[model samples]
Target: MNRPRSTCLAVALVATILFQPGARAQVTGAQVRDAIADAVRHLKARQQPDGSWRSRDRYEHGYTCLATLALLLAGEAPTSPPMARALNVIAHAPDEYTYVVSLKIMALAQADPEKYKEDIERSARWLMRAQDESGLWSYQLNPVNYDHSNSQFALLGLNAAAQAGVKVPAGVWQAARRRVLTTQNSDGGWSYTFRGSSYGSMTAAGVSDLLILGGAVVSPVERGVRNGVAPGCGRYREDKPLLNGLRWLGREFSAIQNPGHGRSNLHYWLYAVERCGILSGLQMLGRHDWYREGAAKLVSDQRADGGWGTIENTCFSIMFLAKGRKPLLVQKLQWSADDDWNPDRNDLEHLLDRIGDKLGEPMSWQSVPFDAPLERWLAAPLLYMQGHKFPEWTPNQREKVRQYVEQGGTLFLEACCGREDFRNGAEAFLAETFPLTPLHELDSGHPVYHAYQDVAPAGLMGVDVGCRTSIIYSPFDLSCHWEQANIPLLGERAFDLGLNIAAFATGRRPLRDRLDLVKVAEREDINEPPPPGDPLVLAQVEYHGDWQPDPHALAHFAEYLNEQAGLRVAASARATRLTPEELPRAPFLYMTGHYAFELSGKERAALAAHLRRGGFLFADACCGRREFDASFRAMLRQVAPQGELRRLEPTHPIFSGSPGFRIESVGYRAAALAENPNLSRPELWGLETDGRLAVVYSPYGLGCGLDGHACYNCRGILEADARRMATNVVLYALTR
Candidate 1:
């Protein structure tokens, strides 16, 4: 009902002033109407209990003048009852109200015609009386009483009135512009009711008004205008009064950058950034996607009330809540022909059939359609957020996924939908664990793009397209906008690569798919037990989930497991194998050629128990049983959340010696490795809070699927990935 708190003061470019007259105005006729509406609400409230205004209430002068300026701003001539009542109220106020009232008279002039011109002339004359020879408006004619806050508002009212076509004296405008600009702070923000310190509200008021007024100022009046682009005085090296103003306006309390800065309670910055459409301006400045992440932060901070409000913090909080009204789903879906994408039952059936073949099996290749009839179209590699559930899995896929984890394979997904809901369906299908695991903002610093830059579109693509990709280039499409759904073929160099997205979300302690952080002890205590700890039992068994292993591979796995765990299970015992009871005693099992079937019945139970009992099981398929990943997954589900296992990395103490072996050296070798790869796809694995592996695969495996497979030869994975795998196993087993 009242003005939304602070009545007047413009942000950035809004404060541009005109000395001679209107030059280039940012405040359009329509925008002025909106601003006026805001000002009037507050002015009307300031019409005191005494049929007059009181200077004690800063609201009185600021809003009254703001209302007048808003009306003048739009040339909305007002002589009607509302205008006359406003005028009468101004007349009843004291001398302290003179500076503000002058603008009021200026506004009243627009509505009164020549027939009633006397009022207009009289109003301008009264305004002249408010200014002193010093060229600045003052409180009770006292300069000290009138600081940056009051003075800036008064001059803005003056500028607004002048721009409204009123014949403001040339000298009055020039003097006022100078007075205001000089008071701005180095930070480009304003302090409490004045100069120096920068407050979000004032920064908005001052900067907006300055840009607006300056935009309207005749060129000569701005001959010495400081866009704040020089090193004269300001935070940035550039003279960016206007830019800095906007920056301050958006920079309330949120340190939207570093992970440590800006808590959820930081409300002001979010408020300013959202309402200011700062992103739009930044785009104009060529900083693409600059505000996308900020927009996300606001969305994440929304309150349960669907509104952001904190007592008096309501104005900004509400603005923030309203900033990102909805996820910026590219192709912003509306209920139209494309709503369902299509409606012919035959077409739907065809798509369904294609999906069946593309995925081969229903459960294995996930596509969960939400129960809501409205969501029938989200069928491809869709995604559902944590809040939702995946469609139920068939009994077979369930076991299949379970074994896949045991075998150490990750499920990668790329998803996007409009008014449609794919993630909703995805939730129903992948009911393994981490229904809500989300994608973190992938910075340029991430190595995904480096993994295969031109070969595949590898960037940290956010789940929401509009938020991630600012400008989609496409010479192929009719228009320039590159629509992902339309470009069926891999367009020149395009593919939403989410290799780690899936591995990061699922995997058993996958060695090569994620953050392979291994502390390198450049200097180890040579006198003490060696890191390799007496050769560190460098034994490894390469398990390719594609095919079952021969007895030799099994023997390698068993012997390596026995040695790493310090168990004396002889290679001769390979025929019957030691039971689960004998397996836990071994501290480690560093073998590859992963296959749940090769694992004896006792081995599987012992492996699960071993994990629970802090046993380490490093499984890296050496390309033997490529398809048995399902088998591995099926087996591990029986132990913990299938999503828990992740790939290990080059740094997992295994690479502590070399400190560089990763996916590039090896290959993406589960079922089959990628060709002409940009990087290697080796993974490291770990457990979560419940002792379930935190990683099914490495989320930060640098170049896992890019270059040649590091696991191409039996010697490669064992010599490279195997060493790290061994170290992790030995350490985990001993620690556990």
Candidate 2:
């Protein structure tokens, strides 16, 4: 009761309980796929004129057979030409065939039993004839002594025969069991004929054989494979010999032998782990990182052809890569909706680089964030970065933008706080120069919100935030340099308006396409040293390396624009670095740390006039903000009455967008996402204007309050405010 059965029972118990919920799966499915791929490569390499591994007189038939079996287990269709050829060669091979072809063929036939019925039947007969009267088939048909490899192969083959309904001679099983017992050394281990090499691989195989054939507990074979005997058992001396075998196999596999190699055998070793089900045994052996190391090696061994070769190297390489698939294909995110604060920026590359550093393991597949339009953010989020400006558009850019807009586009613009001296600085466009469409706040109940719902903040912030990747805001904004009067402000108006424009324009296209056409709008507050669209002061961002736009990539270029280029209105949407389908619906989309569309054409002049027209503006930190706000103010001039954008009150209509007036945004004095449920609706909460003066305005969480203007309680929160603020803005745009 307390013997061999316990160990076998343990193996069974582990298998059963190991798959429970949260019980991390073993050797992920991908590893298996890769291992199978490796087997295919090996078989492919072995293919000869007959479509099998046989070099005219080379006599590597056994190796070829082994390779075929491995590939067959990989789902290589037997009817397939390569397999058919291999089978043909095997049929014509010399006599005395014995490499467990029957067992290997089992997997091949299982895929389509009828097609390989004759093959299986023939193999069964071959095995029966190959078996000796003593029940065991040793190496090359005859053996002097009994022990691990040879004995286990016979049992394994016979076991397969039994499973397939192939008949074996009477008393065969009983005799094999007895033969195993006789070979058992005093210590519970069994020695090879003369006791040579002992190792884990051999021991594992032995354990499998005993379990498959003995059908008894505490069988001498069980101890022989598992822990080895204490010393004295019976007269066989098999115990020491078996332990020695395991030692040999273990050292053999573990020994880092790179013998002047163009490629190491590590890959094959990994393949063998899976092929031999060593992964299961390793787990039981408590080798936690064993599989991971194997995976790492696999990654290093990949060839240009995307396939593996050799039974020893390529096998492990493919299996290891496949095993690590779960983690590799995991696709991580930097900012989850559940975060305490929402970040604003348009730099996707920065986020990618950060996460890439943390991945530890390299990813083999292509993954992107947000499969939908870029403008569907939950809030009218802002994108802010420092220093660099976009490169001048190529000859095709104007056409692209024109085409993009005619289809439907909404781009917003604004002045920076640091450059607020210029009048009508952040207008949609310079009415005096480039007269493009003047961007007014979009009309209330516009299609932007209605794309998914008719109301504001329909899905909590409503719909989805569309911020597929992590976002960041600028550390230094507010740089007013307009010849006209400039106001100090981080134009939330511009950001929101831009969102509507982009959504209306590019929603039909993809985020990637839209990113291709956008040009950073010149801040109306800043009169450029040169003309806007200066080729000398521009950059480019693209996925493939061929184009190498002057701006380089999004993360680098956008950050440069935000920090060094003194860019006020930036348009940054990074595809490879960030995934954007995570946030709630908003008018404008922000990235790692930048905004899109500063201001161009008539929009710039309109903004200038709008400010002079006493229009109000709101801004705030979406995520961590002290630096972002500081940078934003640096770009403002008289643009904002005060060089600041503070919170508003519950009475603000922007808060009216959703049911709950509460502003539980990502960043705030405290967070309200917890207590607030009805967060999606429409209400007017910010500034209600009659086009007179900027005297009456509230800076709720949406942001307001500065110099001469003071918002009550720094934009007090209400029961239902975000929706109201949204409604208020729509109404403002409609009337203004």
Candidate 3:
């Protein structure tokens, strides 16, 4: 079940150093978006007046179907004029050729499966009838020979049709799987025809075809019976042919050209690669980051007209980028025996499918080995780890897991079959990894319970890392329930909880195709030491109760200052106590927490003395907690008895763009805006002493926003506005 230790260790080291923040790819998420938009515009402009695109004379119907599928996958609405016209053409098209019929079925199924169900079913029947006696597909019915390309498309079309509630015969899948296994070359690759040598396009086609056929035979719902204790539980081990084919594809991988056949039908090959990678649920093919490399190639290869060579090629490239760039929802941790970690093979897939349906967007998931590098681990926002037995990890592995979680990754642990041993082991692992923070049972009021769907409490426990609960644990059998076809009431609750967890972890933000680039930019600014000079040091005041509720907020805000105002600031804030010795080193002191706290008289006197020395004090309630807000306001009263805290006017320097961004109005989070829709202008309070803005405070949360992530049900200013406000305040403080 586990890879050889030497191989795993070597790959881990190389992956770690290669994908480090400093060595991120040059292509960014913005550039990819621009390229996609350009391609979309090109396709729109190229649409024929008759609502069909013609590439080759004889295969115009197939070309049109390809174009329509590409556009639809790229987020084109079916009701749009271009898509409506295209759909109309496809709906009324003849089903004479196998290629055209297969493409038409896929397009219609994706466009509006329910609305075009009959068309999809009819096309699927045509494809099923066209299958050769040897369980392969050719250009049309009664063909002498069958090719891998045609067979792959036929299976893809049928799969889409099946997903749209069509009942595909099991015999069709069984025969196809058998033939695909038998035809695999000695070198593990596949050829266009049985007599020819293997190449990239055909290999991809072969691998994807097997995956489709295999998945159909042993569906997600049927996978529930494994449950780790059943006979033949090692399903992955049994898939030797699939594994061999993957190894071949990995060995001959390329995004620039079809391997072994340079530049010939490269777009078609890339499309096949996308399908293979997606179906296998893998981020890497051997060592290549397939999506990243492929996206970069496609973006660079685009012509001035925003197309790639021919219309068919353009459509293929578009589909590759559109479908391949889907955000990763979760990565199931592959640790221990494969059966132990993934008893129910399709649990994450099924859960993601439901989540995708709810969001009206495509979501992806993958299985990542626990020994994988930190970069690979951080690719997805959430890491889902489930097992029926205790996970015995080495010291190095444990440390790596700790690093991943601390650096903005959410860990979701579940005990399969409600195993007490796994639950206890998970608790111990969490305790060891985060000694300072212990897992506590989450209450019904916690955000995870209501992030999306409001569900009753199911005894979920979590560990608070910085401003959010980064580690969540469930001592129950959720994965088994997820694998059920017609989920029971308890299974429905499990899905609801899974949805909420995903929403909380991702904040419903679109994950970039290349998240490493963004992470690198942020890390270089926030984690790297400042230049050797007199840099402004933003210090956090250590206090009685949960003062460092957002441990990363100050550093992230310092990064904002460096980026926005060209300020020379320390990469990390210094945590200082309220004493004379430590107070003078930091002219700007930040104070924030979640719980109510009273300052000792000595601490109060020290703060008052610091303010007398012209030092600035800025504070905000973490997560807009009422206890902290009230306590902070009271502390200000006691510290400066004569000064009254007053709301800063819109004309105040912080709001009037004295430092940088103008802030006449700001956007609030949904929870905050729900209660105060009319809230617009900044609502910051200031207490002046000797006509200097000695103290500035916000009752609403700012730290969570400064951390550059959303907190479900958190009442706060949005990230952009909060960053702007923080920058203006820091600039004003330094000058005043």
Candidate 4:
């Protein structure tokens, strides 16, 4: 909840606030929402009854499409009256103009891709046909006049269409890339027309287009600034033309108007500024918030009737405030085998979902055959391969995987159900690939365990090792547990493990420091009561049935909290059944079991009261099974119907913030992977009362992940990960 906002106000035209040390404070999400609401009301009032906005002769289609997009960005549902009206106009209009066709394509793609797929593809075809020989687009369908303004919109539409499943020619993107590269002036900025004097608006548009087309701009100076260098900032430079253009924009940054054109194209300039900053992933431009500053100007400049006038100006202003650009997904690879590498042994869907959830962005997954050109896999930051027996790679394939690992690409290998072939083949491959840097055992001390969550080693199974080159190998079957029931269900620790591996592979170790952690205190007095006011003491909850599957689990976790997080606690976990008398002193109660059990009326009342009194109950099943999972849900319903178990959002504080940890379960059902490979990803569930987490539950047997204890024929999260989750839960409960 206290996350620093990444929003940046517009560049300096309207904003006079100079950048200074400790001067930056993020605009909260709530502020952005309020501004959007006002903008949306203004747009709605300006809409025509026919769902179209007034436009220049023959440009009504284009204006309507643009306005529709703006409304969508302002949180208008696609089916809303205004959006539907605009879509209807687009659907019926004879979209002959190049700009109209292009804008229509984008609007439809965003509004309802499936329902309007045919229209989108047809418009896309028209756009491709309308392009001039110079690989640029003009406003007119076949006009010789071409400029970056028209070209940028065309490219934007094409990109949107491509994502909506419209097949765009590979050559289209290639040719566009070439055109932008050739048009760049020596000064690293573009003009309205190629080779013309450089200007701010056109430069931003140019950079955005190039980035969209996958062109890298070199920054002439580090941080893309030159003159107004923040004192003490280090000097570093990458001389890409794109970077150069950004530097020029930063230097002449303005939210009020186009620096070169002045107020002539103010709204247009703001829209281009939004695209450039967002596409480049820069929150600040030369110490300015391009978005925040631009938004403030637009809000203040709005006409009394809520329209910026000229229809075009209003549309552009809405677009700028909406910040309407989706983050591009980084390419990723999943190495494939001809036979065994398939539906069941795959965690591609789960992995992407986890990455999206954890990173708060979307990710696209691509599959590469085992024998595909090594160059193919090299482009991705992470490559996943899991099977019972990894097919022996051709010598070339072997060399490729090696090079990939050495060149900072990560290769994740998990044996299928502890398959001998996979384990043996993987080890052999490692031996041949890196004879000098042999695979060494990975202990709890490794950076990977504590990358996101503080992980404790439970020695789940087999030998897990890591090489210096961001390479990690697990002989156990990790995918199976993740893909159980085709839905990820192992545990948070399991998900955390997978996410940490991916993050590390991508060179993003947000939680990099491996804290000088001490083992948890396992010295809780089993029979004695806690001393008065021992606020941080952990209590073990005992119930009937197969509880205490891992008798020392709670104690191990309590010790982890004390040692890693420095929380004061009893030497060991205290055990007590559901009793009002026994529960008052402990604010945190931990429980787990492998079988179903019923709670008596008195026990139910006691449990309910404990939770209502600010007590936190954390529980997990010993083995992921229907019986225990069902019973656990039933018990929660009986204890607190309104607080029945529900899945925790990936962004929940428990997953981030205080403990900021994640974990994953490894291994799988021998034949289950093949049977259901498209299930929903695993999740963590909790019961809440008064907006505070009252109970934390995991279907996966987290107990098995403690103390290297193995459950009877059940897979558990690795010890390191289990302990990490344990630490996080304690931290979350105490702090949140």
Candidate 5:
């Protein structure tokens, strides 16, 4: 009643608003992916038949926890077979060691805590009881000897469990933080025992513990880094002890071993370093590539069967190599279109999986409707959109897209089902979105193609899409390809391309930053290497049985790659035969025909050797001919046992970048109508080895389109799209 006496007084009350900070830079997704995949390959190969990975001695709970955590961090879902099995092992096994119990708590916490609510709370309670009066833990719970190593694990598990809604006494955390801070040595690091000489592993552990406590004291050195002041520009600031500990780790950084200690717990120490870096958002430990350099050491040491000598070592290495356990989430927009935008698209998960696999981080996929602010999704590193035709946006909606692009957002647009109307609509929308800037083709030398992998540039023809800043547009039906593929790995090129787009969108550098780095490198070089020269040479295989269906095809491709794609080309495509000697010399080979063909034993051997030595081959049938298909499959089986044809996915890099482009298949239109109606996907198959495509083949005719004069002669990918595909293949071969 008093407030009602003055309406103005009631209106005077205001709410305080806080502006969110800009997105922080993330580690290159590709770097994370490669490391995690390598570590996982090692873990999986060594896992026992019972779903446990065993050390030489026994199947330890700690190993099981670590392995599960590693796989979870590497993007394996909780429901995934390996993760489910590992969890079951931990759930069934008895908990004895404090370390084992703590590790299990942490692993379960990363998974759904509610799903394992009783287990997590029970394990967490055990840890609290196990903690020593000194606010630390030791390997043995009953003896109550406090040690930094055990303390770190106890704190980690507690924090994880607490985050999952388990109650941890506030005093327990406070006491632990105080204990760590008080015990830290003057050098800014810690030791296993109180007041001991500071070492790298212990220091990292100490820093990580304090970070979890959220009471880390900021030093002047750290403030300067965070605020971009003198003494620390372009670096993140951390708490004082953290700064000191990190400084100590940096000073002692070694890829071969953990700093400040011998190699006894090298992998474990490396894992600690990774956690510290991730938590602190530190990109580099001084000047060393902490993730990459560390990965090389671990990968080189991995056994052929894919495990370290011990389960603990394997788990530690896997966790370190996979980075931390944080999961990345990617969202795709759901919008109005001619085709059903929310069609059953189960295959899309594979794309997310590939991205996660490469980055060593798990990815959660979401579908966001357009009703909300676009920024809600754009705030993410990447967003995808696919439909046959886009509905026209209101003026307000258009502004949202504009802001999304201008505010460091990336938009991926694909015209589904190869619908020209959709492609045209997308172009119009783009034009309206950024009228001042015309869409331009990317050059082959663009960093996007080579960010994580060297990608082939699409030759002269406009492929699936073109890019301008944060936007990528394509007319090809990528969803169809993703939906139809059986093997997750087959459509790597499409994924590679998508990754490039995402990388560019999320982490695009300013032109000035690039130039500055270049200048710095030039100034620092002791011996300058000359820049790469021009006049690139590509060799093609001239094999038996009409391999050169369109003799002019090579010349057309050469011209496009040379002039339009920004490469200096030789006069003609270098020709080679299937003989061992010639095959070895042809790094990029093209083989195609409608007739059956045979290879001599020498040729087969040479072909196998060529593939092993990193040669790439592109084969196409002239018009869906069974004869060429049968012969090529037989020959591939002979040349490489691993050369089974797997259908290409839509996310392959071949569909991205300049030399990478997407194409619609003319034959697939008929296939869709005749076979399943839901299968409007053009199919490409690949023979892969050691994670690289050795051969790409199309049973549907690509030769007729390349011939330029025979578009009507075959049921296949259209002429322009065919040219785009050929360009993509040639470029991929040359670079990959």
Candidate 6:
């Protein structure tokens, strides 16, 4: 077989360049999801009356187990009709072959481990009994012919079983780990048996087996690095056989075809690649984004019927997409060239594992370079950086970090080992990156301390960007404790603090992958300048306080108006003061801030005169800050002393659908709902002048939501509702 040299170049190019904003415009998260949905419909249609998807004769049970596992991983509920029927079939099916039994165990364990505990234990024991002295499995027990493929499935089943509370002896994992290490060829790849040429499928299988056996939960030995000797740390390390296998696979990686075996068992190879990537906590292996490249291939290869090929192939494809597409919760940043930035290499993986177990959902994380594109950084809501020393960054990289935070990404800075150098550098970096926003020490009562796990008095400092605290800095070592999961109370505290930060940053919301937020060509129109036909110039009022908390809010709202209301708004909003000269240039004025400031008497008189002249002003307290709220109310009273600022009832025309969809009720952020559980109605106050509502106000935040960013602790309306409300307010300002 002639290996293609271009494959290496393709992977390198994807790694280095394709992560830019609009590089891979054709492939998007939504498109991948739609393809998966289409494949799911195809699978549903292919289900037989017996709930088993038909395959080759006598392999029906194995295929059924595979299909059921795929569907379960694909977000299908166990109570769904097809899944229920499949489960029933799996329960009664005779487990004669090793493959079928392993697959059945996997499916049952995934469906409901507690409920299927007994069945999983039975299958796990069967697998243990079937293991040969060499720690490999074959088609049958005590078989003469053992293969890596069967061993891989057996390990997968046992791992799942172990996760579901079934006890498998440590010796079994040790023996398996030893066998794979010894079997690795000098070329760093694995063959079918111990003699054939190395191929992609077996190499992937080998890598995945090592990952499972050396997993944080399953490894029997201590997790350390020590010359790769006997009884060494079973966890993955730099100089390990696992890395060697990964290197081999990476050298020959191909998403479209199984290397050394063209177009055969392709989906199976892809599935193994997903397992390897996810288990290793790696986003790129030898310059290849295994998930991205493979997902694009599978999506394009999906047939009209949605099946990749045979029943087995389709099952593998589904599993690859479903499990691989799991959103990333955090991206550990590689800030420096050396290991200082990652003293505790597995810190994030261990932290995410604990968080996932606590939340009862799987979470994913990866490490990307600091210079990776803004789009890549935005893949996860949180970007984590830690080091013992100050890491250097270019001007462009510093700007990218700021852009990431501005684009709804949170920056988490930690001083590893409580290093003073790192802490000083972090503070300086924040100061430089956000010169206008100063860091403030978070009190014990801050939500970061209690967002999920209460770790009160946890010393943390933060910087508020836009409507949220976008920068969280810890001037102490937490990753070290996270790496040492066996540390007494310290480990638990570290995990708790880490989980709290994640929850506070993400609001426990479902995250999106990089592809999900890729800028497509169709959205380019939003940034294009509006045609010169009396375009509405949305104006933001500048003031003494932090008036422009969210710089993009007005522009995004303008885009929203253009898209939703067919209004021709200028591409950019104009920032102006409350001078008479500037007030008349735009009829609609938006003002929001996070601090308190009183308008000058002259400016107040100009604003009041503008309102009296039929100009409309919309103001909200950014992030629902009380300071801004109180000051705005006082300013309103001063500006319109005679006109009472009364609450607009649900019966008001604005809520009654005069301008946009009737919003009798709107969704508020979790923080808002926590404060006021019964807050379903729009909370707005209006002041009328000359029998027309000239000024509208909201104590809650609208700017952050209008900017289309996640503000976890913002006591404000949800994004969708905020945009809708802004739409209604804009229409009201224009028409009324």
User: Which candidate number maximizes TM-score?
Assistant: 3
Question: The CA-based lDDT of model 4 is what?
Answer: 0.63
lDDT of 5 by residue, 1-736 (tens): 0000001000001000111222322344444455567667777776677777664433366677878887876667888787888888877666666778888887887777889878988888888888777778887667546888888888878877776778888777767877888899987789989878877778889877876775322211212111111232112232455456666766677767656677868888888887775554343455454655676677667776666777677778777766542333445665652124533233345455456645433444444456544444543555677665677889888876665554334567776555677678787877777664566565786545755567675321121111124566655544544443332442455566756654554342221110011100011121222235645555656666566555445555665676666666554566677676666545777777767999889878888888888988888876666788899999999888865778877777675534566544333323224445554456778999777889999887776565433222244665567777777877777686
Give the backbone clash total of model 4. 45
The full ranking of all candidates by lDDT, starting with the best, is 3, 6, 4, 5, 1, 2
Better of 1 and 4 by TM-score: 4
Q: How many Å off is the CA of 227 in candidate 1?
A: 32
Question: Which candidate number maximizes lDDT?
Answer: 3
TM-scores for candidates 1 onward, in order: 0.27, 0.36, 0.91, 0.46, 0.47, 0.86
**Top-down TM-score ranking:** 3, 6, 5, 4, 2, 1
Q: Is candidate 5 or candidate 6 better by TM-score?
A: 6
Better TM-score candidate (3, 5): 3
Task: Write down the worst ten-residue block by lDDT for model 1.
Answer: 1-10
Q: What are the C-alpha RMSDs, in order, of all predicted structures?
A: 23.4, 24.3, 4.8, 17.4, 19.2, 6.0
lDDT of 4 at 605: 98
TM-score of 5: 0.47
Model 6: per-residue Cα lDDT at residue 551: 70
For every model shown, the clashing-pair count is: 158, 214, 0, 45, 22, 0
Model 4 Cα lDDT, one tens digit per residue, 640-701: 98866888776776665456465333333212233444422334688899888889987765
